[model samples]
Target: MHRLIRRPKSVERDLDILSSIDTKGLISRRELMRRSALFGAAATLSTFGGVLSAAGQEGGGKVTVGLDSGAFTPILKTFAPEFKAATGIEVEFASYPLGNMYDQNLLALRQGTARFDVFDFWPNFVGDFGPFLTPLEEVGTLDELNFNDIAKPFQQLNIYENKIVGVMIDGDMFINTYRTDLFENAEEQAAFKGKYGYDLAPPKGYKEYRDTAEFFTRPDQNIYGLVEVTSFFVYAFFINQLVQLGSEKGVRYGELFDAEMKPQLVNEIGEEALRRYAELTAFMPKDLAQAMPWDVGRQIFFDGRVAQANWWTDMPKGAADPKISKVAGKIKCARSFGDVTVLPYGRAVGIAGNSKNKEGAFKAIAWMQQSAQANRWVAETFEQSLMDPWRNSMFDDPKSTFPLQSESGFADNFASVSKELLASPKAYLDISIPGTNRYLASIMQHVPRAVTGQATPKEALEAMTAEFEETTETYGRDRQIAHYEEYRQRMIKQGYWS
Candidate 1:
């Protein structure tokens, strides 16, 4: 029988393991197999509970969810009915501003209010809630759920001391969204290729990225190159880049307790990465440096005012709308390249540690992540599902490949980038340090100095090292170092390092 063949689109099912490519370097085959074996076991266990699929649940009691307001409203609302029908549990959903949603959730969790059964959290806040979240391993073994199919690095992300404590709800991996209309022109493409000795594509490294930014920067046309966010998300993105510059694990070595964990005062490579970040952004418009620029940063690209943007998956949708996006037909997507590395961030979900409804909560959390709810959400919302593989089937979906009145170039570009991201093995990282919020805030202030030629990279690294040491010490270095060690071992086990 001849099977129908479909082409991949920017919105189609992705084949790239966008966040899975490990850059910690080579390791022994035996170790590689060992980690793979553990992942295999977890993957098998992920799908073990087929008890009540996302079919629909009914009215038992309201399980409240504290969620950040996002574009996936329709999908989220749709799931409520399905979940209610399947489990007889009604959902009481409350939306919050992104700023303090997690903090609010934690406050409620710590107070043992049971006001919300589930809380929506970004990866940065996962560490904050780790101590309070009930490990998923307690409710369902990794063998039961087919965890491997979800995404490459998510299961490992939920782990704390061998316990799988969370379930991933979205596949929000980072990618470079570029303006193809500007780059695809024969003259522009030729000029870029001639200058760079490579095809005119989204940047593959920091130097190229900077060059492209400068190349496409036509301020006369109100267009800029290399648009970036300087918010909390930006800091996480910065951390990822820092890892790419350094050896395995970058500035964050393993925990003090872990054998693989080493205490390092500074990583020169990481310092350089931060320096580059600040230098690039120093040329950015001043208003772009605020704590909330990412939300509006994509509009700069969508309006055809910027040549390229470094942002998460949600940014592309801004360009999807024809009215708002002058470059709706021209925008494209790809992974942000650097030394061919993928440092995973923001692929975390965890249960509250002090919940009375542990069983119900686990079931609810697992249902949202494992069932059709997650896959359909991506299909309908055009948002990248959390940083994982649920979108794999959507790679070539018809809806993703629609030939709209807009140019096909945008779709094609996005498709190519998504494919590249999905094809690689994912590398996961933790931002759940006890004082990550404060540390990142400080890094934001100081890292820019180094990038803008104010401080040497070594100076920046020393400052960061000192800041981290001070904060971690105050927040309990022993505990924080333990988590760092676990993170390091995880990288080693994944063959990110020898």
Candidate 2:
């Protein structure tokens, strides 16, 4: 029946399992037999090895960790070896796509599978999965871990029911990553200022951002002014956008959601705030009107065909790699456009509720987040550090091995922003309202329609309100009202509404 191929991984010392499922009539009998024999050998060895490992761990042995595939792979590859050498403890890591990983972990925890010792948690779902994540309070004490070194807001973001559940391992700031070479030209700058009535510098607020986008846009030249992740809450890009633009929110971006998983805005502030999304999208690439945030949008921006763009910390590497990017050298980092209160995306590491090897998993996470390992990973990965607060402390330090900057003190430029993030409180924005996942999805889908003039702001807000109300009602009125109340307070403080 089935043809199999036998192969051994020369370097890793692992057996390969290969199967030839296709049985087309094109191949001769002798060839088929040869291929099948090879396949069968490899499959046999692979099965035998897998059996031995399973038998070895039948009772219990090591900590199993789940990581989101993609960038995390490179990060672990770079740091795991060092941690293993230093501690003599090895962490078994399982990688999967973001959606699949979360679902698998969720099911495993619910079924008490104990398939994972540690799991990655997102800020939005951190609260949702609180019941399933092992509270750090039950395992390792934070005091001994020097929890104070963790930025305050970020620390708070990980707490659920007043107990810390997740520790942010990497910090990601959202800002405009633009082509400096394009903006540096005097003629381009003059024309931009003349058309937009503002200097051709970075956008400070929503209006300014739009003006500049329109000014630089030369459809006939195949060049556009601004390129941003066109998602429903690209409006939330306004979260950082607002702060970077000099409009301070009532709550710090980091502290938007608190321990209770309640909305932190003052009133229906998100509604009006979303209006800016409707306006700004008018100037973005048309693909945003109906494309996923990470799909093709980033690739286009990194190609250098677009003038200015916005994204999280990892965007640099995405746009800078020579193989994948054309405008790498032109990309320059800057302070986020709108708010002073920095809201960094959190990469949290926590023990799984059903983990069998709690101690082992904690050891791995500790090693991963520790200053030395995290610093090295930051340097190697170039994915901003949420664990290390200093953006540039390693520039001249002899201990610093990362080759981020050629000259000394260049990192100091990031210090102010880094310090602000670390010092600011971590807010629970993404997970604040129940059904936020759907709400955010709806925003991503509908907001673009409104932004591109397919729907009016009032129409978008009305639809959002209707959906928000329905989702809240599904959760219960009392809970919804309570969240609205807290949100109202936050808005009043920020001056969104009286």
Candidate 3:
């Protein structure tokens, strides 16, 4: 049978390994075998008592999931057998690479082939996927699941046009984490105060953040201030930084667009955000543009080469792993240094509108969020896991932390990460109207252009605006405007924007 997930020809179903491709595109044999061993070691039987499984499931030969290749995939492998034993439902995953998953899922779901029962998606693309997904609330058996426990910002993403279409799977947002060893050093503190007129600490706002980054730069020592992944989620670095420019007064769409759906890319805030976004690359490796954004960036910090790295809860979590990080106990998680910290992109898995088995699919999605399950994934002894702590309760487990980190206690050390999550009183949802892919695509293609100084920030924004307008026109101007208006109003109602 043909498979949707692209994998090695020699790799087989029974092999039991977690795999990854390097930047050069060669597969490492040792890493694959290592992860496979961990997969066997980490999983536990579900004590969900039938609530997570399909006690009332319909015909269940196999239930397919349109999944992305991420840390979460391996976690699912651990539980798949338990789910099968409980519900008699075999799990088949039709997977794709991270960036490619959205387009492939769209292709699979749009056909009448019943290709996927459920698909993983980001909030930013809800508009495109909205039509293809079933309102999860409409699925009767899922009613008892506590919908309110999810973070409000995430709640904003899953509810589109007032219908709950997806389950909150990833609380992927930006949070600045810094080297406490640097910040707490008396000599560095005196030097920072002497140079910048302030005590060295985690920054509370934008200017301080830039200054803090600048203060830590020491290229002669091979130490730089900050590094952000340039290749994939660079767009997030763009959005979150720009959003902070207007965050204090509660800007509606941040720099996404004005109330009129006009692109706001050429403004003062836009230029500064772009400049600051590019400015950090100065202290990074010459190949900063090629650096892996999330997990691997942790290594750059642990090596003591950089003072700060920020994005996603996963970074701080993974940084605490003793086996991998030399600076494991030295990092501290904190709030965005500026105003807004909104959803630039996040994962929210949902049942396909065209799925032949909506009930079984909902069960699987719900299963992942069960309190016990959520904690296991977040606190999984392995340093790198598929998902982050999306639920508030994930942090409630006081004892769930690295073995070496028990000295400070998990609660005290983790306060910063959790506080960062709730710090943003307001955040903008990614524009989720039709042609969202086109809308974002227009903007993303210019990220490296403007940041690398190849294009003036103005030129980049103008180029993006042109593309945005073309996409808007192609999607029908008036219809999209109405949709945009509806979206803004909904965000206001949901308190995403004041």
| lDDT (C-alpha, whole model) for all candidates | 0.57, 0.55, 0.68
lDDT of each residue in 1-498, candidate 2, tens digit only: 998764455512322222332222223435434433433343223323233233323333466777777647656754443344444455567887865654776677787578778877665565456677888868777764556656554554555554677877665556466777777779978887777666787766656667777777776777787665655336456455433322354444323333343433333444455565455555556555344365466767767767777666556545654556788556665544554544445577788787777777776776565554455555552443223332233323412422343233334434444454344333323344345565566556666666567776667756765665566667776764555455435444543332
* Model 2 alpha-carbon drift over 4 Å, by segment: 1-60, 143-146, 232-235, 238-272, 287-289, 320-324, 340-344, 381-402, 407-417, 420-429, 432-434, 452-454, 477-498
For residues 114-143, what per-residue lDDT tens digits would candidate 1 score against the true structure? 656777675555566777777778776665
Segments of candidate 1 deviating more than 4 angstroms: 1-58, 71-75, 141-146, 193-199, 247-267, 286-292, 340-348, 381-391, 394-416, 422-428, 449-460
Candidates in descending lDDT order: 3, 1, 2
List model 3 lDDT by residue over 1-498, tens digit each: 987985564445324322322212112446435534433222222233342334445536677877787656776666565455455576776667887877788887799877888778888788778888899888844444556667667767766676878877777777777888898899999999999887888988877878887888887887778777776666777777777776753555464656667777787777777877777676676666444465556678767788887666666666666677677778777776765665667687888888888877777777666665566566565444647656666555434423335465544566545655655666667777888888777766887787777898788888888998788788887777777777777767876576
Which residue window of length 10 is worst by lDDT in model 1?
A: 10-19
TM per model?
A: 0.76, 0.72, 0.84
Residue-level lDDT for 323 in candidate 2: 54
lDDT score, residue 353, model 2? 81
TM-score for candidate 1, please give it: 0.76
